[model samples]
Every structure is written in C-alpha cells, then in structure tokens.
Target: MTREVRLTPVNEQNLEPLLSVAVAEAEPDEVMPPVDAPAGWSQARRDAFREFHRSHFGGLAGPTGNLMYAIEQDGDVVGMIRLGRTDEPGTLETGMWLGKSTRGQGIGLIALRLVLAEAIAAGARRVVADTRPENLPAVNLLRRSGAVLAQDGTTVRAEIRLGVSEDVDLLDAG
Candidate 1:
C-alpha cells in the first residue's frame, strides 16, 4: 500500500528531526570536485556546513524568507525539505533529504510534489533545485518532474514553472 506522507512547515519544536536528517546526509569524507566546491572548500568546510545546518534550523524559529518543512509518514518524521529565498516574488530554490530507511520507496517524489504544490500555493511562479551530476536519483526526479535543466555544469540547476499544462507524473512513475 502506498503510504500517505504530508509536508508541514518547520518550527522550533521540529528542529531536531531536521538537524538529524542533515547530519545523516552529510558527506564528510566524500571528495567533492572543484565545481561542486565552487567556494574552494577544505576540511574547514565541515564547520561551515555545521554553521549552515545551525542557521537553517535556527531560521525555523526566526522570521526568515527561507521556508523549511518536514515530511511525515504514518505520523513519523521521514524527511525534510527547504525552500530558500521564498520571500522573493517569482521563484525559490528547493532542497530535500529522506531518512535512510525511507529512501527508495517513492517517498522522495511524493515529497517533492508536496513541496512544489506548497510553493505554488505560496504564490511562487517557479521552483528550482541544484544537485550534483552524480546524484542520478535527484537528477532523475527533477527531470521526471518536468524541471528543465538550465545549467548542466558540475552542479546541475533545474527549474519548473508552475501553473503550466505540462505536468510531471512522479507518483505514477514510481
């Protein structure tokens, strides 16, 4: 049976699960290519990553344009999604990660749909995401979601314009 998962806005009380997912997905030892590390990162990058996580979580409690949300399945937190630069009028960037046990079960696609719907509901005309070229799953999801690849460099940038007749059948494909 397909499980019903819901995405809800992140808040102070829900920060732990968000951080847990970030820590769980951290690739500390993974060698990122120069393009992936456009900012010229090093071992010190870990601290920067930590700070990013901290600020993201902290943003949930503060007034910020970044919108964070948690994915819940069967009343359990399975993943998290974020929409940055949401205060702008036209478009926003999206990010997401599922818990280890929850991956590959088609939840990611559903979660993405939910977030996309949320973005549209929030008056966003478009949604964007950047993922490493090696991240086939994410790339495929974005492709399958009808997000056009605007930039195919080290980190691919994909985007979708909302309220279009062109649609993505993520749940059916899964």
Candidate 2:
C-alpha cells in the first residue's frame, strides 16, 4: 500500500530524523554537497548535513528566504523538498531528494504535488526545478507534474506555471 505523504516544516524537532534518513538510506553524493569524507558518513559529513539544514531554519520566509520541509511518509522522514525565491520574481526554484529505499513507490510525485500546493499558497506564479537528463526518475516526475522542460547543456530545467490547470485543481482537491 502507498503510505500517506506529507510535508513537515523543517524544525529542530524533526531535523535529526531527516538527517538519519539521509545517512542511512541515501548516499552522501545523493543528498548533500561534498564533505571531507570520501566514503561513509563521517563526523565531518554528518556535521555538514546538520549545518546545511540549520542554516535555513532562521530564514523560511521573505524575498530571499527558502521554504524547507521534510518529506514524511506515514509519519517517517523519507526525504526533503525545498522552495526558494528565484532571480525572477513570482518564481520559486525547487529541489528534492528521496532516500534510495523509497525512490520508486510514487512518493516523489505525491511529495511534489504537495509542494506545488505550498508554492501556490506562497503566491508563486511558477515553480522551476533543474535535473540532469540521466536522472530518468526526476525527469519523469517533472514531466508528470506538467512542467515545461528546457535543456541547457547537461542541466534540464523544468518549469511549472502555477496557474489554473488540472494539476493545480488536483492539488486543491487533495
């Protein structure tokens, strides 16, 4: 059965669980920037993870702040999604990463729809995401989410306008 997916605002209470999911179920390269450790979750890598999330705790609103949330499946932290204001006004740029164990269960699509609701609520006219063509899963997710994709070299930018549409209506109903 598919578990209920929800976006929990990242806070001190859930940060540890988010980090636990990142280290145990995903590789360092998959979810984080490069740390001093080459393999495994070292003290430096773990610290870096905490620092990364901590840096956002204070700034979740305003023009320059980012909205961060942990992707919780059935009450367990499984991944994360973040939306930040882009250089273009009324546009928000997003990024997400899920643990390897939960990659193919349609969790990403659910989480994505949830985030889209958040984006609309935040008064964003469009949401954009960037991924590599080789990451077929992400490419497919963005396509299914109704994003108009444009490629520049190795990066594929998926732009979803949050105006009236079937997807936005579904987000409203759900």
Candidate 3:
C-alpha cells in the first residue's frame, strides 16, 4: 500500500485545486491562520487561503522568503508543506498540514523527509518545526524524523540538524 506521495511546487495552475481541496477536506484553522469568517468555508476564507499561498514567497514574516509545496497523494492535493529561512544563518523553518482524511497515516513522515532533503540540497544545516503540545502526531513525526524537541509553554519546537551523517541516514531508513 504505497501512498505515492510527492511534494509539488505550488503554482498558478494548481492553486485552484489546492484551494478546493482545502475548503472541502480541511478546516481553516488546521491549515492556515484563523480567518474571521461566518463559519464553514466562506468565500472570504477561500480568498484568504489563496492570498496566503500567493503572497508567501516574498511576504513571509522571516528574513528570507518561503517555498511552498502542495502535498499531493496520488495526484490529488491533500495539504501543503512549507520551508522558509530564519534570521540565523544555515538554518531554516518548516511547517505543514494534512487534510483530515489524510491524518494518522505515514504521509507526514514521508513529507518531512522530502522537505528535509530539499533543505539539505539547498545547503541548510538545520531545520526547525513548531507545533502545539496537543499535536501529538506532529510531535511524534518530528521525533521519528530525528528532531530534538523542546517545549516552551504550549509550543513544542523540534529542531533537526541536517549536517549530521546519522541524521541523514535516518532519513534513508524505512
């Protein structure tokens, strides 16, 4: 039961399908910033989702720009994965979300490894991820992917050193 999951670069052609999948399969809070809409996937929330992905390249809240990828499972957009730079040199930040229907599967781990490979190929020495303590699945995925976890209040920060040979090996294992 191979999932045939791959990260596709988000572009103009795929934006509509990405938005559609998100609106139908995921809640706004689970995938994007809290949009003040009148419940359900309203037009305003849909528009915001488009703009969020569109404006991210140069408008992110980081020193460096962001790279966004559509998480495609068997050619359908199920979620998104993002990599961005931090103020610290040789380091990058990561974030992702999967549709509710896709949760509890190994898709996230595969996505993490793919994104980490992208980070390594881009010469990033480390990658960091932040999630809430309640996101046990993400915490476990980060740990299994070789990230060291540190909890600050409700936020759990996972940091992975990509420069280590053993860490790279972990990526290849399973």
Q: Rate the local accuracy (lDDT) of all candidates.
A: 0.68, 0.85, 0.83
lDDT of 2 by residue, 1-174 (tens): 758999988888999999999988988888877887757888889899988887787544533377779999999999999988766766778999998899999999999999998888866778999999999999999999999999999999999988643334322231
lDDT (10s digit) by residue, model 1, range 1-174: 869899877665665665555445534332121233434334355455445544555442245556667888877777677876644346778888777777788888888998888767655678889989888888898998999986566889998888833353221221
Which regions of candidate 1 are displaced past 4 Å?
21-63, 86-89, 164-174
Please report, as a residue range, the 10-residue window in candidate 2 with the lowest summed lDDT: 165-174
lDDT order of candidates, top first: 2, 3, 1
Candidate 2 lDDT (Cα, 0 to 1) = 0.85
Kindly provide the TM-score of model 1 when superposed on the true structure, using C-alpha atoms.
0.70
After superposing candidate 3 on the true structure, give the runs of residues whose Cα lies further than 4 Å from its correct spot: 57-64, 164-174
Worst 10 residues of 1 by lDDT: 29-38
State in Å the error of residue 69, model 3: 0.3
Error of 1 at 103 (Å): 1.4
